[model samples]
Target: MQATLMIYDGTAAPDSEIPRTGGVPLAPEGFIWPLCGDCCGGPMQFFAHLPVEYGVLSVFLCQNNPGSCESWDATAGANRVFLFPPAGLVAVAVPESGVTLLPAVSAIKTQVVTLEPETGDDDELPPDAYDLARSGWEREPGEWFGKQREVLGSLGGSPSYLEDDRLPGCPSCSGTTEFAAHLEEGIDRQTAMNLGGQLGYVFVCRPCSEGAFLTD
Candidate 1:
């Protein structure tokens, strides 16, 4: 029997000029660490380095004392997102004190099983660009994922409307939340946050600085 190659889930070590996930964030030369406001007094975890047609988007998450830190609130100092030009790249300076970063980051490497799954063999559609890119990583993990890197915006396709029963309430205000960001696994396995084969969804309560993450 052939051994299956499974997806990877953890912070990645990236080479220069290549955008990656789970490694040190690329920031301005004089960039200062983002301090949390939820009384945790710590630096956020570097989650992703997204390079788009215009600029790069850096994402961070704060889960220090998740029980009381209110990291879910976008306004509670739980997470931060930064956008800037790639020309101004610099490694973030880690602070001597406070929570500097998360111990681990989610990563994934997908193996192609079937394009649309073998559903009764009625009709066959070739795999789309997103699906092929994800599978292509198995051939050349070092190659840059052009458009796939930006799939987080619309999840490479339309997002399903999640029902209220499946959604989570805001941790801070307990109000209904709205979809904020689609957290897809990054260009490589190290930056991929596996959600049981589903894309990750982020919802936020802007007024309370609270947010929620779940698989859709």
Candidate 2:
């Protein structure tokens, strides 16, 4: 049983302290761009930049009119999750006219696979450890499905919690929801996001900004 995957690769320049997703946003030089309490007008969709251990958690997602809003429901209004504080970092603030940054950063790497479980003899064990790491990426589905869809998008860590009931609830008050983000599978494979190789997961209930999305 092993699990340590952080293998982005759409570009680079992120490591102000691990926990990343889209890019550009160590916020505070003037920090401004967090107003989509469900489209109070616009400006939401930054989607993650974490830097925890005492600050920095930025996440947003209204997606304009993406499927008539409701983001998923967290409370309706889509998404938003701030936290800042490492002395407030800096830089992010240049939208006097247009703003929606979230597609220009990527290039992490930290593989460490070794969750084996199938060794011939008619192999057939995988029933846990996230299906034995998706059966070791299906034993190389044409190069791990194009490197697992270019390391999908926004997947810093904490997955393979191995079916915590598959995580999802709190459509309003059902409670028990808080995983946050990991939509992965996209770096432009023609608009990726298939997840056929598994990943999705977004859960949330932050006071009910409501949200849920599974794919495992």
Give me candidate 2's TM-score against the actual structure. Answer: 0.29
Cα-based TM-score, every candidate = 0.50, 0.29
Identify the candidate with maximal TM-score: 1
Provide the global lDDT of candidate 1 against the true structure.
Answer: 0.52
What are the per-residue Cα lDDT tens digits for candidate 1 across 61-105?
Answer: 664554566544445566665656768688776777655544444
RMSD of each: 9.6, 14.9
| lDDT digits (tens) for residues 46-74 of candidate 2 | 64565534455665655566655544444
Model 1 shows how many backbone clashes? 11
Model 2: CA > 4 A from native: 1-42, 46-99, 104-135, 138-146, 149-159, 162-171, 174-182, 185-200, 204-209, 212-216
What is the number of residue pairs that collide in model 2? 11
